[model samples]
Target chain A: MFGDLTVDDNLRLGAWQLSGRGRSRRKQRDTSWVYELLPDLVRVRARKAGGLSGGQQQMVAVGRALMSRPEVLVIDELSLGLAPLIVADLAEHLTELNREQGTAVVLIEQNARLALDLCSRAYVLEAGRIAAEGDSAELAASPDIARAYLGEAQGLPSPPDAQDDPGPDDPGPDDPGPDDPGPDDPGPDDRGSADSGSHDRATADPAPTPGTAKTARGNQDTTVQSARAATREAK
Target chain B: MSDFLVYLITGLGTGCGIALIGSGLVLIHRVTRVVNFAQGTFAVVGALTAISLLDTGLPHGLAELLGVAVAAVVGLLFGVIAIGRRGTSPQAALVVTLGLGILAYAVEVMLWGDQGRSSEGLSGAVTVFGARIQTHYLLIIGVTMAVFAAMAALFGRTDAGKALSACSSNPYAARVVGISVTRMGLIAFAIGGALGGLAGVLLAPMNSVAFDSDVALIINGFAAAVVGSMHHIGRTLAGALFLGVAEAMVAGYGSATYQTVVALGLVLALMIGQAARTHSVVAEAG
Candidate 1:
């Protein structure tokens, strides 16, 4: 295969010659469709492949594999060296493929957040062994599972449904403080509504703040530790 | 006027060989993403092989064919060795190609004993427009034209051509479609090597063959490739012709030592062009 060939020609080479399926016509159509999805590739189709950016090269590699119409698609590292936005877009597309085509994709990724978000079920492999396995939600909520795959220092948040339930507020028969209103004072419906609203706020408010605070604190701690270490070395 | 025409013809002849080598370098870079420093060595090896066979009383045509075949094998070996290792850094691969070039030069020195050998003229001179020109020049023009035409047809009219094109544009997509990148790389190297060999054979009669000639030829070829952006063969050929003419004119008008300086200036110009374009792209992206 010549490197100087047009994009369509290159696609056809992998299509007809590599697969030996004799789908030259279909391959051309497929290439056009691919161009529709990745329009930037169209302008550069006539351009040499070596002149393309790293992301574009990754797209070409993925497109070439798609031409074979395989049941199982295995991408070595989906997020490797790509910008975050492009990786997110690619992950979204892969999810669509999974939903529409039922294609089983084996995506090996070093980014745990991406993997957990994209896959319905996952196995966390550490040192080539399955350290943990469960549904995304279950594993996310499991503290033990999080500690194993993700470091304890990772400070991963619990899943949305894993929040603590509010206990019933019972007023004792003997006495009540002025600030503490009796349960019957507000009526059952008002009391119930207020209780639910407060519960929602209590659960949602601290969740995000703690995560951010943890990150900020971690950064500060690292900076302090490094400074201390430098001072010690100087001494 | 006649003298100018004679120099033009000579430049064109040299340009043909440079274009072939430049195009080969571009092709290898397209597929493997490495600037092969060994390309000149491959050319020299091809020339030496042909010379050895010719010295043994073999026909020139047969000797040339064997030389091309050997060069193809060498190219295949290079592709396998340099590109086969998964995750080989581009810098490491370039260093390896340079090493291979040195190795090839050493082998040539061992075989031919570092002596300058002149080849017999390729079918004598031909008269064109009242000026004497070598038939070899016409051969070079004809061969280069034919090869470019064939490449255009292959790339524009064939399936394998499209696959290669796609591979270059987006390797990941190509792989997802099941293109064997390694196989494509091998094919790219073989074709590149064959072209380099052809250039060597075409150039053998024009200059004295020596082990060290590889470095200059490879440098010139790389410069040509860069000047053309390693894309269009026609542009690469045009660039080579331009360089050849400029070099000849400089040699005629000034000291020969200035030719290297001129060539260096051309390289600097091309690099500046590349950097400016890259800077603009960054700005646009921002």
Candidate 2:
């Protein structure tokens, strides 16, 4: 479905079962929420999903599912074939979605550290048998359980702070996360940093002041975005 | 040049009919991955239904619509039997459509008999570019264009249309996105059937439709669809028009018997070309 369809259309199909007033309402709410959740998707909304990179495709897939407004979203593998940073960013979005929308997410992951970090409850399956089940914090702390499944290969040190976001110095996925600036939180600092990283180079020759830099960066972003949209339309 | 113009105009009408059927074939194949051999049967049934209804003093327009509706119902039935099963492979579904075609043939024979049937199509000739052409041919052209336009809009502007295309692109992902693949398949078959029926109703007056006439219609339509690689609607229509014009020219310039040879040769050459292209692409990818 994603392969040949535009990101917008793919998102529309997610809410296929809805129609009439319900459809329009659901479509407006879910689509806006998805666009907000995955801002990168906004850039490539008109582009064919097949043309997108694998990570972009995955984001579209997640966003598409979210458009359905499912009460319990079952994701097959949240971290598959993605960089750990991307996985972290996505997990953060999922957490935010859960918190804001009260949408439950069931993530099936091989990466136990990430899963334990994001989820409250944990269930371990080995050879079609239930190996262990407990609170995620207890499962993560258990030496025997961690050794058996979450060993050196699957092990990545779980973020120590629960719900405490990475700091400004941390140039990890969180800093440039699309879902970073929630509606309530005005992360002006993060925005400045993100603009500096992506838009600074383009505007460096002109050496714009801090006051104009924001608007200049906004203009450049739109220009680049529209250029991409034009190319897509031409295609 | 006048003679050529006459032939081209006539060919355009014939091409429109063939293209309508080919479009149906292509639509079904695109969504369901099934080459519906029974598409021609939809035309035969529709024409027959319209003709039979005309005998009951029904208006021509209403009869034609009824014919299309009947064809859509038959399409849904075809979908249920052929594509509704969970494990049915495309190959299996294709064979089922063939069986349905045979079933339609039997039904046509029972109801309409083996004799040729005709309807009171618009009778009169119009002069265009110093050449006389049947007015009904123009109607056929108009109808085909209208149908194509509607389909294009449906696909391009509508959410349902996008969902159908999405189902074709990846059924698993489509399902995950909450699209019912079975529903899309059924809709595809029904739309394909309606298109086939409309083609039949339009072509009935121009050509005497017998029970077995579908064999020729399917053959020509299939030939055109194969030329487009069974995906592109515009390309399929163009292929149909090309086949129609080529057939008409061959019949006019040479003999009617030679037209079959030309069609067969064209199909063979195009299929081979397509095969070579696909093979090279696959080799390159590998």
Candidate 3:
């Protein structure tokens, strides 16, 4: 029933006890009906069912079950290992069958996104038990819903707030002070800074306001001092 | 030139027998994928049975008819036993048919002994284009032609034939469509056996009838079928004709002892043809 038989043969094998006349009629009707749903199968109608692709074989298997005119169709892992596009196509047909034929379809799938999209209502199973139940949209948006149904991990803390941090006005040790020595100002340990400090005062006092000059001088001396410290560290 | 014509006529006669046997082989192979090695044995058994019955005071036609009927029944039995038991393993079925061939031949040897027996030809003769062809040869040709025509009609124009073809193509699908593959297999075997019996009846008068005579006929028939690729009936007939003509040419131009060598060479050529086709299939797959 599962292997080597053609699609039509598989169907006939399932319904063998029917009267010969009735069997042929049923077979023809089923063939046309199945072809209508999955037109690609029409080409391989005479081909062995075992030789078809995974998706086509699945359709044949489903078609065999349908030939019995079963009230309920139970398909396990409808999207298992199938390409997304093929899964979507199969899902559309299943939905059509469900709506028009009133054939109840139980589709089990691992792709939560696809399952949620196709199914009207779904049960999220965890460890073999129902963990949650709801409509698709509600399930898609819930935080806990997102975590469980969408397979996202729960219980991770959020990052700290950006608005409450200290303002940029406060300075650290790197900032220049008003009393900071000029380049030519004599230092406790005299270097070239003592010579450069008088020259700066001479050029600065007449050129700009004294306070602005003093701040400018202090900034320059601090920069030079930092450079000296960096060079010493390198050496 | 007269000698050449004689060789050609002889080749044609032998080719007719080979054609009949090859067609039957193809029929069975198409449906069940097994080349029934016992096909020739069935033929011999049927012919010997007819001869034995004639010796017992039965009318010749009645004995022949009874022989054909018995052969058909034997085919049905072989179908039931060999095909039913082995299913889809063509190789296993081939081996089983080989064993059955041995069994049938041994039984014939036990009943008739190893001596050669001559039987009467069908009847009458006619001059065809200045060649005095025997009435039996005409009968063989006419009967084989009719069989081929009937087979073409059966397979081409009948519902039963289509169903059988479906079963052969895909047993599962055939089963699903409500065809009983087992029943179809039986039909194939019966047809093949009946054809084999017909070939034996045609050839029995021309050659010495013995227990081991069927082996050569079966081998030649199988070789012809293989040479034709076993798919086309026309090709199969052509292969039989080719083999027959080659054998006759060898017998005429070379020593009679070289006949076996010619046959062996023909078989080797067929095998090489099959091997070459198989290599192409592998290359395509790769």
The best candidate by TM-score is 2
Backbone clash count for every predicted candidate, in the order shown: 38, 0, 9
Q: Candidate 1's residue-wise lDDT over B8-94, tens digit each? A: 787777878888889889888876677888888778878888888889999978998888888888888887788878667657888
Compose the digit string of candidate 1's lDDT tens values, residues A28-111: 446775565555578878765434554555555455444444355555455545555556666666676666656566665554
Interface RMSD of each: 28.4, 15.0, 46.2
Q: Output the better candidate (1/3) by TM-score.
A: 3
What would the DockQ be for model 3?
0.02
Candidate 1 Cα misplacement greater than 4 A, ranges: A1-18, A21-67, A71-235, B253-257
**Which of the two, 2 or 3, has more TM-score?**
2
Q: After best superposition, candidate 3 residue B46: deviation in angstroms?
A: 1.9
Per-residue lDDT of candidate 2, residues A1-235 (tens digit): 3566888887777666555476666544367778898887899999887676545666776776666555655555555445556666777777887778776666655545556767877676554455677777777677765554344322335454322211122233222222212222312221111111111011012222111001111233432332343233223
Q: Per-residue lDDT tens digits of candidate 2, residues B65-155?
A: 9999998898889989999987578899999999999998888999999999999888899998888888998998898999999999999
Q: Record all residue pairs in model 3 with backbone atoms less than 3 Å apart, i.e. clashing.
A: A5-B172, A6-B173, A9-B173, A9-B176, A12-B176, A183-A197, A184-A196, A184-A197, A185-A197
Higher DockQ: candidate 1 or 3?
Answer: 1
Give the candidate order by descending lDDT: 2, 3, 1
Which scores better on lDDT, 1 or 2? 2
Q: Rank the candidates by TM-score, best first.
A: 2, 3, 1
The TM-scores, one per candidate, come to 0.62, 0.80, 0.64
Q: What is the lDDT of residue B269 in candidate 2?
A: 94
